[model samples]
Target: MERKRDYMTVQELTENEKYKFWYFKIKECKESGLSVKDFCDKNNIKPSTYYNYQQKIRNILC
Candidate 1:
């Protein structure tokens, strides 16, 4: 059986795609009842990098 991927490296995505990707990830993390560090660890993302993307998303919205 083939497994599907739920994540992609930011470099493989276009600029807008990257934003949306991280935005959804942040949202998913928030709704998963997991702390940011735990979520990042489970997802293979660095906590600092996740926080940076979260800040970037917020800056875009604000």
Candidate 2:
């Protein structure tokens, strides 16, 4: 069986596009007020990745 890849690297996405994509996703996830684990599970994102994305967004915002 062929496995589906979950995501792309920075080089694969334009800077603004990457920021916008995760910005909305993280915004929506946080708005739900779900635990990180539950949110990741619901959104099909890995815990570490969710965290990394959060940090990345924070860095971008600040």
Candidate 3:
């Protein structure tokens, strides 16, 4: 029999963890040299989520 897998909710991640997660994602996007949509499509990440986080991080920095 196969067992189920558990996943943590976004609420469970600390603010710093969330920052690091998005930071890496943005860095990966830059290094990949692919358009945001293309990179997100290849990684199976929601493009909206990527854009939202990018804006959030910018806001935090400013």
Candidate 4:
């Protein structure tokens, strides 16, 4: 029998972790005075993905 490797798959992140990750990125962008595009580019994240996360945070707060 072969053992399965779940570690190779994508791991689910907790809500707190998600919040902290996005919050840090958002804060970094603000402090760096970089446009969203530049920040996402420098960070190797897609702008659309970053925007979606940003919108989700705003929606939850409202």
| Clash count for each candidate, listed in order shown | 0, 0, 0, 0
Error of 2 at 10 (Å): 11
User: In candidate 3, residue 11 scores what lDDT?
Assistant: 70
lDDT tens string, model 1, 9-56?
Answer: 577567779889999999999999999989999999999999999999
- Model 4 alpha-carbon miss at residue 53, Å: 0.4
Which scores higher on TM-score, 2 or 4?
2
- Candidate 2 per-residue lDDT over residues 1-62, each given as its tens digit: 97877986677568778778888888888899998899889989998987898899899789
lDDT of 3 by residue, 1-62 (tens): 97765965567567779888998899899999999999999999999999999998888889
Measured over all alpha carbons after superposition, the RMSD of each candidate to the real structure, in angstroms, is: 11.2, 10.8, 10.4, 7.7
Mark the regions of model 1 whose C-alpha exceeds 4 Å error after superposition.
1-13
Please say which candidate is ahead in lDDT: 2 or 3.
Answer: 3
TM-score quality measure for candidate 2: 0.70
lDDT of 2: 0.85
lDDT value, candidate 4, whole model: 0.82
Model 1 Cα shift for residue 9 (angstroms): 20
Question: Which pairs of residues have clashing backbones in candidate 2?
Answer: none
lDDT of 4 at 8: 41
Give the higher-lDDT candidate: 1 or 3.
1
How are the candidates ranked when ordered by TM-score, highest leading? 1, 3, 2, 4
TM-scores of the candidates in the order shown: 0.77, 0.70, 0.73, 0.69
TM-score, predicted candidate 3 vs. hidden true structure: 0.73
